[model samples]
Target: MRRIKTRVFVIWSLIVVAAFSLVGCGSEKQTPPAAQQAQQVELNISAAVSLKDALAEIQKNYQAKNPNVKILYNLGASGALQQQIEQGAPADIFISAAPKQMNELEAKNLINKATRKNLVENKLVIVVPQDTKLNITKYEDLSQDAVQKIALGETATVPAGQYAQQVLQKLGLWDKLKERVVFAKDVRTVLAYTETGNVEAGIVYKTDAISSNKVKVAAVAPEGSHQPIVYPVAITSGTKQQKAAEAFTEYLFSAESKAIFEKYGFTMGK
Candidate 1:
């Protein structure tokens, strides 16, 4: 009877060991809960629409190196994005096409001041449809009666629009041309309007103009016509993913990111 009991105990021990081994194998095949959570992290980035192409390239390169991190972009007018953030939008990072939007956020204590940095620069330009025969050769030509239905961003919110407004005001054309303006929500919208010949002309960033085959830059807004076109990047004060946001922000200033921006016609920030 004792011998029988000993054999039964050995058999039970073997069964228990097999069960544990199977569990160990299962664990090895599955990611740990902690690791799974880490891999699911999504960073929400709000950026100006003009940055779409360059930022998309940067996002691709960044994701290649950081397979675990997902970047979700909300591209639009800087002013619209600023208002969204102010209304408690779930944005981890903010990149503005102009300092005015960033400055407002900074003043409201909505952005983490320590993480703020100027990312790039752009030039405003007059663009027209590739097939256009308009005699608009310079910024001043927009004042002519022959040019009607010009597209510009809403000066109150869009940085590109605001810059264009500044230029028009500087050139003493704002009052005369405001009546002929078709306001766009963002620079990209203006580009589309110009590209499709929906408008006689549009004001947009040089970077934006170069990205499109349908639009030709008719003239570049002279320097000092407006406040400098600068892109400012910052981590939002409300972000829970501060470390990840910081990593992405720093990456924007890296040589790789700069190269991509330059390739897209953006000038690196000083």
Candidate 2:
């Protein structure tokens, strides 16, 4: 009877060990691997007011090709844009209508010097209201008392204003009509003033005048009137999206992008 009891105990011990092993294997925890991270980037661009049309088109094309990237743009007078960038705006790239303001930013180390490139060229032109049939072609005609007020960008900092001042000086009309000039914050403001009849005439860019049917070109400033107009694009040093920003700077030089810029009356830069 004692031997039978011993055999039964051994059989029960083997069954218990087998049950324990099966439970350990069945209860093992399996955790799913973590989800893969998404690769999305946002790029911010601050550009001159003159680039509004071209930038809009370029943004569309870039997004179509790179679905992962999102672009945000700030467009204003070149001086104002430079001020914003200096004040720590989160700008990935900058496109300035004039080089002087860009040089100032570059001096302050606000933008990457190596990434700078002359993207396009523009021409200045005088404009008048569309409905008004003004035959005042020569720059000297602007000095006539009938002209009352002529609008231009503020010459102190605005590129368009500076160019206008130079043109007036070249034509020997600046001293005669200084008092009659209506200063605007930017070239677009000058266009607005002329379109609304607030000023008899305005000095803006040829590309600008072509965009608006509300005004007619009075004359394109002769090449000698002002320094050559060149647009420069640069990548800001503060950008967090370094690769995206660099790609964008290069995109400005792409032939497809140049065609879009030319559609807005911009000339190809040398």
Candidate 3:
């Protein structure tokens, strides 16, 4: 009986030893996190198609500073972007080229009112392919017989398109030129139409024309022709990463960021 009890005790002690050894090995081999995990954040930003180049520049610096955050941009007309937000698209930030679209979203309670801020201001311009002698020195020139292919964003949907219509109407040329208008899905597409010679001329934001060397600004739209072109940005309600969204929005106001925007021909809203 004593021998059996000793054998049982030895077996129990061996089991305890084995368990301790396994725990020690685990402690030694267990990998601590190499570094603070990049906060896995996905920020979906909807911006005006006109901002493609400028925002692309900002994204590089923004990502470098906030390495943990991932930014995805949905670039299109402000109106379309607003519609998407209203439909509950997964957008974290909304940057509209026109105040009306931002106001529309605000009315629907889709934006974080506290985070709303004016990001930049842009001027409208008529552009043509490089070296084109359309002699388009004024908006009324759009009505000329020679100018058959006039590309503009669809006025009903795109802010740029709406602005173009307003400018033409203000100049008393809307009625005559309405039929000649070639509607594009977005201002960028309108710019492309003119740049690629698909159309002879197009109206787009001056900043957008400067962003690409493929086109040249033919005329600056008169200041009184349309409402001020203001870009307002706000964090959307669908954002899971509110802090990251707000941070990115605020980054637009930073001096470094402002300079980058200015380099692309956008005036700081402030």
Instruction: List per-candidate RMSD values in Å.
Output: 1.8, 6.6, 3.4
Residue-by-residue lDDT tens digits, candidate 1, 181-264: 999999999998888889999999999999999989899998788988999999999999988898889999999998999999
Pitting candidate 2 against candidate 3, the one with the higher TM-score is 3
lDDT value for candidate 3?
A: 0.87
Q: What is the per-residue lDDT of model 3 for residues 214-267, given as tens digits with 9 covering 90 to 100?
A: 988889998788988889889887678878877787788899998998999999
Task: Give candidate 1 misplaced runs (Cα > 4 Å).
Answer: 1-9, 27-36
Candidate 2, residues 1-270: lDDT per residue as tens digits? 999999999999999999999887776544332441244889999988888888899999999999878999988889988999999988999988889989999999999999998989999888999987567786778877789899999886689889889999998889999999999988888999999989899999989998899999888888788998888889988989989898888888899998999999998788
Q: Against the true structure, whose lDDT is highest?
A: 1
**In order, what lDDT does every prediction score?**
0.93, 0.88, 0.87
Quick one: how many clashes does candidate 1 have? 0
Candidate whose TM-score is highest: 1
Ranking by TM-score: 1, 3, 2
